[model samples]
Target: MATRAEPIRQLRLRTPTDLEAEAVRNVAGALNALLADTFALYLKTKNFHWHVSGPHFRDYHLMLDEQATQIFAMTDELAERVRKIGAPTLRSIGQIAGMQRVLDNNADYVDPDDMLAELRDDNKDFVQRMREARDLCDDSRDAATASLLETFIDQSERRVWFLYETSRRGDGTGH
Candidate 1:
């Protein structure tokens, strides 16, 4: 006898909030993209951490591990923020890949300095993205998300600063 398959039920986890539907939609959209980028950056940081070599191996490894941990910490809060606003967060790695703006670095080997420079640039871009999201939150009057983005932006800026300093040579410029 053939068994009938059950139809999937669409779950609507609509949380009640004073924010308007449009505002929720806008904030959720921005947050979701940011979350995806966060995941991408986290993975890249971990990759570099695991693969790093040369004289500064221990320092670079520890720094990337710390940065990776920090990046991973943001994922939960970002998704929760989207859900709190009555929207569905990203459900899969595929969703994250689709939405992520940060480029992946899948190479056999990379110079440690090059890795730091690349991550610095990516983090700088991420800071701008957060700023844009904060502006959107301000426009939507979603002070909660705006405040969260502010914290994340500051953290990202710190990451950029670290990467920039580490990658620098004699002149202090990363040249």
Candidate 2:
């Protein structure tokens, strides 16, 4: 005998709102995309942390570990924000893989400087994405999301600065 498939229950959010449901949906979609990218970056950072080697091995490894932790920490916040707005969040790695825009580095070996440069660029790209999401929130009058994105943007900028400075050559001129 064939078994019947269970019906999927749709989320029934009851929060009263002055904004249109469409606007909330749009913002949640944007947040989900950002969440996927953040998870991808976190995994990439962890990969580097685990495999990084060279003269600055210890420093780079420790830094990447810290950065990965920070990126991982954002995933929950992003998901919760989407839920708070009456939307379902990513439910699986496959869903995140489908939504992510960040590039992955899977080579067996990478130069220390190359890793720093790549991460720096990735962080910069993440900042740009965050700003774009913040713009979406602003357009939708989503002050809460906009405010949270401001903090994320600041953190990403700091990460970019650290990576850039670390990757720079010590020519003594500080150029």
Candidate 3:
């Protein structure tokens, strides 16, 4: 005899009494995209941390490790925020890859300076995306999400600053 298959559970969002359902949906979508980008950036930073080699290897490696940790930390918070608003969050790396705008580095060999520059540019681009997400939250009047994004924007700006300073030449002449 053939066994009967279990019925799939259909999840439904219990909309919060305080927030508008439409706004919550919009904010959750923006947060999911932001979450994807954060994951991509986190992985890239960790990659650089592991492969970094140069006279300043210690400094660059340590910095990337710390930055990767920070980026990773943000991912959970972002996913939780989406769930809190009664929306589904990212489930797999493929979902993230589809949503992410950040470029990946697959080269077997990358110059130390080039790695730093590439990461620096990527972080800068991330900040821009964060700003766009924040704006969406603001427009939706999702104060909680918007406030969280402010902190993220500040952290990203700091990362960009650190990367920029580290990549600069010590000599008076800038590269």
lDDT of 3 by residue, 114-163 (tens): 98899889888888888888898878877888889999999989998999
Q: Model 2, which residues run further than 4 Å from truth?
A: 1-8, 13-16, 172-175
In candidate 2, position 25 carries an lDDT of 88
Question: For model 2, what is the alpha-carbon lDDT of residue 91?
Answer: 94
Candidate lDDT scores, in order, read 0.94, 0.90, 0.86
Q: In candidate 1, which residue pairs get closer than 3 Å at backbone N, Cα or C atoms, i.e. clash?
A: none
Among all windows of ten consecutive residues in candidate 1, which has the lowest summed lDDT? 2-11
Question: What TM-score does candidate 3 reach?
Answer: 0.89
Output the number of the TM-score-best candidate.
1
Candidate 2 per-residue C-alpha lDDT over 1-175 given as tens digits, one digit per residue, 9 for 90 to 100: 5334322345354345666798888999999999999999999999999999987899999999999999999999999998888788899999989999999899999888899999999999999999999999989999999999999999999999999989988877866
lDDT of 3: 0.86
Better of 1 and 2 by TM-score: 1
Estimated TM-score for each candidate: 0.91, 0.91, 0.89
Ranking by TM-score: 1, 2, 3
Clashing pairs in 3: none
Candidate number of the best lDDT: 1
Candidate 1 error regions (>4 Å): 1-11, 171-175
